[model samples]
Target chain A: MTETLTAPAPETHPRYAIEIDGVGKTYGSGDGAVTALDLVNLDVRKGEFISLLGPSGCGKTTLLRMIAGLEDPTQGSIWLPGRGLDGLGFVFQRDALVNWRTIIENVLLPLEFKGRRTKAAYQRARDLLATFGLAEFEDRNPWELSGGMRQRAAICRAMIDDPQLLLMDEPFGALDALTRDDLNFELQALWPDPEKTAVFVTHSINEAVYLSDRVVVISDKPGRIVDITEIPFERPRPLEIREEPEFGRIARHLRGVLDGHSARRA
Target chain B: MKKNPLAYIPMQVWTIVGIFAVWQACVMVLDIKPIILPPVPKVLGELFGNFGLYLRHGGHTLGNTLIAFAISVVAGVGMAIGIVYSKFLEKTLYTLLVTVNNVPKVALAPLFVIWLGTGNASKIAMGVLISIFAIVIDTVLGLRSLHPDLIDLGRAMRGSEFKVLMKLRLPNAMPSILAGMKVAISLALVGAIVGEFVAAQNGLGFVILSSQGAFRTDRVYASIIVLAAIGTALYYMMEYAEAKLIPWHESRRSHARPTAPSKPAKGPVAQPVASDAKA
Candidate 1:
């Protein structure tokens, strides 16, 4: 608990980007307390794409948020080396782009807040929109765009500041299946960058297996890690890789691990 | 690509014309006494013939209404912000505003006249009293309705509280505030007239009051017509301003009227579809 909110000194673990040592979160104390996460420990390597895959109310989002310092852990300590809240980027399940702002302006919002809304930053936003194929839609309002485009804009907003650690909480969960698949491919195309480490939360096993360097299966209630599977898929894994037998094997195994935990609880 | 304004008027215009035609038809068909409801032509004749008198008093009313509305918008929005940010004010000021607003404003207008005198001061005071609550209540709703993530994103970026308020919170709240303004503007006219009803030298309210004693039905009808025009004008003015200021809002997403420009009219919104699935 003392660890989640504090600005700890830079860590000596150069190989690890984030260190969670017995981190737990509980909403209240004593009789009314609802434990969201049990004491959980995990180490995230530098430049890794890790997914916390679990069912709803499994505290996957809570865990991701604790790392982002949106929620304080009530027990143990999670260390972020030196990339505190300011050095992290967070994307929610909803796009939540300010409807009044144009797409480019929405992306530039973080910079404006940080007093970094310079000419170069504006250009950087344009470039990011271009990367997402939203270049022509820079000045259009969020409502004018499709659901998928709005989500893309939200992603751009997170990345505009070039945050070292990006945390996303089921970012594509609200979209239609087809749109979600399209965004998943688009996201994986740009992500797993060596410069950035991403912590993603999702219940979709296929998505977790497709994009993650490692998929961590979390148990249902008072969430704790049940199993961690290293995805051995090679670099620049194309969208077609999801069709491969090996990809299904990895996905099915993760699903089995999740079902085993749920059945045991049942 | 300039289109003819006369070619296609909105249904509202035709509806208004139809109402006038129906009024004239009813009067002609029934042979109703002018005292009960004056003939449409007679009212229109009086309206056009003595337009200067009506204009003079109408100008007075319009000026006071605008002044009160401007003051209410500034002060009410400020009060809303204060209530939102301060727990103390949310409890004290917001509750007090709702309580005062619930009191019968017509009864309160005479009280304003007693306090501020029979001049425009009392009228303006009444207008502010009646109109300000909507501005405050709606603005508060708007400010609070902002997605929690927007605030969280601000905190994550270490953004100044002031910047988040000005850019994120206020802009997001604009349409709601403007909606309140629209309701307030019409209510403002009602307040001003109420004040004039109790005691005022000149206004549309005064015209209606004085003409009633003389049984000058034409003059009364003319004054009512003038008030209707003014009220309609004020409403549309607010609507047009809402369309202009927050064209990105959903309220403006309906078919492009002369007042509201649609999305395509905005420059260069061609979404690139070829790269929808890829970078």
Candidate 2:
């Protein structure tokens, strides 16, 4: 993947958090070998919420996984200079809440694994739960809650570690449209730090437009970026921004680019 | 409306009475001999008359069954953990469990008696052999059927395998494991009886055998009734524990707490007939 970003504006390199250079990932070998990503390159500025938007088999999830350190890239390197990515938190498509653990306890799981299970860690977990409107459900198991509630608890767990980077893989895809919108707003409100970097993979074009500062559109099969549209909306973007002509224009323009790529592949 | 929990007791009593009434009528109309078809009252009288004898044998058999059932639970869960932790062990051990489980456990009763003698040891072993299959099969399935996503989540959170088992797999599998134990309890009871039939000095199975040899059919049936009660009680106790431990599980929660009515009717016009018609 070759990156040819025209002229680098000062805003473009915010903090130069992640530099993906010519990463190619291939699975299996011989008849079974599948090239999921081919010649992929991208740069994520610090504190920016970037959405890797693509169709199925486009290696969007693979790219997100590589950034999260869940999968090693076959060719390129992923570096998190500031705070080190070993402390990165991930929110999965499924809630991934341990069914046996209560909501608060599930949120505290990262601390337990990291051997930082002090009383203060627990207090922080409870504080996070309260922020998410889950104080009353702190003692409730995952199965006892509704799907939306479970996903809320999942977000709390993901943020429990308070890492510099948060990797999300279609976190709100399984939710209903109404719940998904509510969560999107909730996420924007509780993003921890304005300068905290986030890499999200999603199939929904609208979700990409709503949650991301830059939407990285990718092609199918040998996944490679076709376009990176920078969203110019102001900070603390309210749901009302969706009705603005600029937001609609960018969204439509990205859709047209995606359509063209699909046409070429066909 | 609240469902009266007591409703089923009266239904059960009526069903039992109907069965006896049909039996009594058949015996009287057919003029069957008392030896062939003793009256229900006579059977009950014999059961109470020989209560001590029945209790002694019943206690022996129930003790053996309980012993076997307990061993099965421990061994099954242990084996399940072993198989899940290692793929090679699972492949080899699970194949053996399946093969042994498929073999009719009753066929092994005589061998057990020969090896362990005509004592409680053989009877307990026989029962264990019968019930172990259920525990192993269910526990393995429960352990292996955990969602892959949950495992990945645990790994992402940097959990050790031991922690994952303790915090996730074991608790998630509780309902299924309890279900398997309930099924095994009945089989364990049956196995004890079969062991007694093969060779035993005591137990309900021996009592039934002796009564049959003497042609005392009433005593035989009475022993059977006692055995059935014991088995039912054990199964329900497991069900009760399962309901308590996994209250969040859908199957358990629905039955754990009785639901309150949505709201009481406002008027006397909301009678049974009106409600039925509306339904």
Candidate 3:
């Protein structure tokens, strides 16, 4: 972590919220080293929604973790502007809700940690849970809620403090298809707020195409970005759009590039 | 299926009733001498008749057990936390504890008596010596058992290590800590009894030992019954504390069933929230 110095994108105004410059990651050294990521570069504009889509072991998660500041790139650097990396909300594949806390308390946890919890903060947490259809379950423990509800609670927690950036790692990957569909809609509903940027990592091509403004395909083993396909579709896209021929074509195109990099993936 | 917990009362009562029946049956059928095996009525009479005497010694035993157990709880959990947060302590203190625990703790009773003298200090020290291991070992395991995702989440939130330890780690370790306490409390009681056996002049253990020496077999039986009651009480007290403290834990949840029903299912069942399978 101490070895690399991140230089900001050469832009003066900082149009990009995140600038990932030729980042690479290698674990260990000498005899038994493993390169998890190759020299990968990406720039996500402010308010952009991007998905790093690839099969497992493609180091997509590793890349996402680097962006979240949980890991450091072995080379190059990631420069996060605006709120920077510290002021961000993160959702894990598992709900990762603190089971002992009531849903509201879990949501307020980050704020509490920040020493910023106030009466208004509590209200904000309540409103966020209510928006996620979890108002009634606010006082209930995480284990008492269904999987989808628990994840919604987790999302509420992530959003409670109005973080400028959101990082989600396969947030809906564990749920049933119907529940996943529900959450996807819920997420899309809130995505238009306040130029907040999000970097999502997922293995599902459909999820990438459906939710992201652009899909970045990554190759397996020493993951490198193979393609970045921008969606031409309009905002607040209805679920019916996925039925369109163009949507299928775009999804298939991303999948084809992903498949080209490694083996075929569902 | 578990509508009324009261339904299990008869089951519990009958099991105890059945054990007493077996005891009485053995006494009658074996034709044991009255001095050797007091009849149920005689023993019960001795218990009620000498309730004051039992109460006095019982109080002494209970007091020593609780004081020693409290000290062990504080020291044991403290040591566990220390071991978890410091590799130095983990390497030295924890390793030493593991080695020390393998020795029979009762064998150390005379040592405590010699070192701390034949008073509450030695008795309490013995109780702590016998019981502290479970707390340290279990609490350490529980503290280290946090899901890695939780650690990452803590980091993602920029939570300080101390904040994470206090708010997340400690609460998560509570169930394990309480479990250790349950075992420790019983062991503490046993330690106090061993201390009393080695040198003490009072308490239930001394009562039992002295009564046996005088061939007052009924008093010995009475003191034992009281001791059993105390051990059972301590265990259940710990269980009650565990249930109250961490009812959300899966192990404690069956006892805390959601009897209030769902919160009237708000929001439409068909949430328009699902974005049309978007592109």
Candidate 4:
């Protein structure tokens, strides 16, 4: 594990932790080319929870994948100061747990890959599982767990390494409404640790408003960022917050943005 | 109600017994010539009477089959790995393999005998040639058919290329490789038999050939029985290995039989957690 490097100038307090400048991704070439993301630029501050809220085929996932270093932008650049691949974690839309391994083994997989499977790492895995209500099911296969439990376990797997930045691509999209709500709250409770930052991608307007500090909404068809809304709700938000006037207002605004995009495209 | 364990025998077992009884009754009622269609009793008698001779020849056949199967597994898996790791090998070697596999293996039996001599070497060679392609194709398919999400997870975890292959890809491919092994084992037996048919002094194939020449239909039937038993045993052995190795696999899980029925008197069983019916 790498230590967090102190910011060079404390007075300035680096406004952006990550800088994505004019990044564009085009797939293939020569008449067969398709642009996934076009001139998308966004900056994320340290320890902020940002959601890339968009409709399908909006390049949100493609953008997330690029941030995770799984893919590279064909144009422009993305810069994360004093961060390496080891400091990043990803939670996919599907549980993505290795079917053959136990929950604890899956959680400890990143450590295993780094050849750093110490006793402390095992303890950390157990602790994370316990936190996620998966302690008793550590030895069970992924198939044996419910969808919610599996996704929770996946979250544990991602966070076990104590990544500074967590990239989640619709991590709760496959779950039922009730399970998705519970997990959204769980995620909210988990994201407050000041050292951790998160970039969440989702199609749910309510989810973006409920959990994100800011929602970056993108439009489809050579996807580009249309708006970045700053959410004013405080940390550790309660479920009742959803029923509040401000929450409804934010959700409605995001829904309008999405509906307007679709209407115009049609 | 307590049921008799004997009554729990599979339907296939009962069907086989019925077929044998019908065969015996046909020979008796029709008064068929012993030379034409020998009675089941006579075949059983020959099998039991020449038990030692049968055992020696069966051992030779089994040895040839096993040695050939082992070689095919190693070479096939090796080739699969090579093909999977290299696009050039997949394009060139895979086509050649498929073409060679399509050729009639029995036609090549005499060629193997000529090259490796009329001994265990020839039999093993025939087995390798006959069985290797299925193993290669099945294993290659398994290795390549990994779930994309799993690959992405591995990459996100920073697994090296070697680590991905060893931990993620190989284990994911095990069930397919085992399926291929089961198919290859049966083909291996056929190859050994074909080689023995071309030229051999020992083995069940040799016994059957010599008995047919001497007009001993019962011995021929006995030799065939031994061959069937060997094939069935090898197949089940492969199945048992597959069950043990990949119990997590859907095929193995679906095949698992409940040890005992739940007691209806106890009412509905309470699950510890809400089972994800949709999952």
Tens digit of per-residue lDDT, candidate 2, span B146-165: 77667667667767788888
Clashing pairs in 1: none
Over A1-95, each residue of candidate 1 has an lDDT whose tens digit, in order, gives 24564646454587778889888888878899988899899999988999999989989988997888777888878888645567788887877
* Model 3 CA deviation exceeding 4 Å by range: A1-13, A264-266, B1-9, B255-279
Candidate 1 residues lying further than 4 Å off, grouped into runs, are: A1-11, A176-178, A243-246, A263-265, B1-32, B256-279
Q: Which runs in model 2 stand beyond 4 Å of their true positions?
A: A1-21, A80-86, A113-118, A141-144, A192-195, A263-265, B1-9, B253-279
Please say which candidate is ahead in DockQ: 1 or 4.
Answer: 4
Candidate 2, which CAPRI tier?
incorrect
Q: List fnat, each candidate.
A: 0.40, 0.19, 0.44, 0.35
Q: Global lDDT of each model? A: 0.83, 0.78, 0.83, 0.84
**lDDT tens string, model 4, B1-279?**
999998989998998789889999999999999998899988999999999999999999999999999999999999999999999998999989988978887898888888999889999999999999879988888888777777788878887888888888887888788888988999999999998988999999999999999999999999988898899999999989987888767665565443232111222222211111101
Looking only at chain A, give the TM-score of model 3 against the true structure.
Answer: 0.95
Candidate 3, position A261, lDDT:
81
Task: Spell out the clash pairs found in candidate 3.
Answer: A185-B275, A239-B276, A239-B277
Give the per-residue lDDT digits (tens) of candidate 2, residues A1-266.
11212222334343766767677789998998898888788878877889999887789998887776667777766555555554678898877776556788889888777778889888998898888777888887665566667778888888888876788889887777777777788887754365578888898888898888899999886788899998877667688888889888988998888888773658
* Tens-digit lDDT track of model 3 for A1-266: 23223455466346787888899999999989999899999989888888999889889999989888889888888888766766689998887787678989999999888888999999989888889888788898766666778788889988887877899999888777777877888887776655788889999988888888889999987789999999877778787888999999998898779777884542
TM-score of chain A of each: 0.95, 0.91, 0.95, 0.93
- On residues B1-279, what C-alpha lDDT tens digit does candidate 3 reach at each position? 667876667786788678778888989999888778787777779989989989999999999999999999999999999999999999999999999899998998899989999998999998999999989988897788777788888888887899999877887788788888888999999999999999888899899889899998888888888998899889889889977887766666576654342433232222111111111
Docking class of 3: acceptable
Could you tell me which residue pairs clash in candidate 4? none
Interface RMSD measured for model 4: 8.9
